[model samples]
Target: MEEIALHILDLVQNCVEAGASEVSIAITECRRDNLLTVKISDNGRGMDQATLAAVTDPFFTTRSTRKVGLGIPLLKAAAEQCNGSFTIESSEGKGTQVVASFALDHIDRAPLGSMADTLAAVFAVHHVDVHYRHEVDGKVFMLDSKEIRQLCGDELMHPRVIVWLRAYIEEHEKQVGGEQ
Candidate 1:
């Protein structure tokens, strides 16, 4: 994947495949600490110890459609290239959490990309529920699809909702980044 957004998409796909009804994605960028951290958690059918152990192997994948599974491996590599760390934890019938950290200023650290759009895209496309919280420094912006669905009825996917989300995220990003 050329961007971290793609990696996030891949990981979310995995969560869906695991039968997750809800997923949570959190991103933290701390310039003072010189770190960018991405964490994804899903209430899905998580892997056992054996599968977890091999998830980082490029040669291992549960999908029969492809011989190489590089989602986890690639994310790990991206973090490592930036002098950071990647960790995956899961349990059968429970859930999984993938946390990756990268050096904030590393030339190799992929751009954060339009994370607000990424979250909105996922929510708009998937019927599954999700709770997304994005925090930069001490400020926080949260989106809960289920809540939106309750308030908007069938209009959760309405164009206005998407537009609102996109704009809300953009505004929050600006607030956190300070008009950079």
Candidate 2:
């Protein structure tokens, strides 16, 4: 993934495909510590220990439609190369959690990317509930699909809703990310 947001999207997609009904994504940037952390958790049919052990292998995939799973491997490599760490924990019939940390200001670290767009894209398609939290320095921004659903009903996939969502998220991204 070119951007960290894309990685988040890919991981969220994986969660959806794994029968997840709920997903959580958290991005924290600690400039003082020079650390950027991304944690994604999903309530889905998780992998067994054996599958989890092999997930880091790019060529080892459970999907029959594809021969390789590059998302996890690529993300792992991206973090490791940036003097960071990556870990994934899963339990069969439970859920999965992936955490990756990177050197925040590392020259090789990819940009965080357009989170608003990425999230809007997800909302425009999948109906899975998502809780997204992003923090930069000490500022924070949060979005909960369940809350939005309660207000807008289940028709959140509509174009207008998605447009509004994108703008809303974008504005918050700017504010919380300190772009303003």
Candidate 3:
């Protein structure tokens, strides 16, 4: 993926396919440390040791649709290209967590693109709840689908609600780092 947001979307889809009911995405951009870190956790049926080991292999996949599974491998390569690291931990019947970090100022590091719209789209189309926390420098902006659902009731997917969500995310992004 060209953008970090696209990688996030792909990872979240993996979580949903794993039968996750809840997922948490945390992004930390620390300019002082020159690092951009993304961590995604899901309460889903995780992989066993063999599956976990093979997840980073492009030719290994549980899905029968194709012979290649490039999501994790591509993310790992992206991080590595930016002089960063990628790691994943999972246990059968427990959960899964994926962490990818990149050099903040690296030329190869991808930009975070349209995260708010990504979140809104996932929430509108999927039956899962997500907690998105973004931290840049010391500022933080959080969006919890559960909270939004509670506030908006059954109209969580309404057009006005999506508009409000996008606006809210934009405002928060500006407050953190100005136009993410």
What lDDT tens digits, residue by residue, belong to model 1 across residues 110-145? 887776777777767776787777676767777787
Best by lDDT: 2
**Candidate 1 — which residues are off by over 4 angstroms?**
158-160, 178-180
Clashes of 1: 0
Candidate 3 local lDDT, 1-180, one digit each (tens): 878989999999999999999999999999889999999999999998989999999998778999999999999999999999999999888789999999989998889887887887787778899999999888888888999888887788877888888788777877888226
Assess each prediction's global lDDT (C-alpha) against the native: 0.83, 0.92, 0.89
User: How many residue pairs clash per model?
Assistant: 0, 0, 0
Q: Local error of candidate 3 at 180, Å?
A: 1.8
Q: What's model 2's lDDT at 27?
A: 92
Q: Please list all clashing residue pairs in model 1, or write none if there are none.
A: none
| lDDT tens digits by residue: candidate 2, 1-180 | 779888989999999999999999999999899999999999999998899999999999878988998989999999999999999999888899999999987889999999998999999999799999999999999999999999999778999999999999999999987322
Candidates sorted by TM-score, best first: 2, 3, 1
What order do candidates take by lDDT, descending?
A: 2, 3, 1
Supply the TM-score for candidate 1.
0.90
Which stretches of model 3 miss by more than 4 angstroms?
none
TM-score list, all predictions? 0.90, 0.97, 0.95
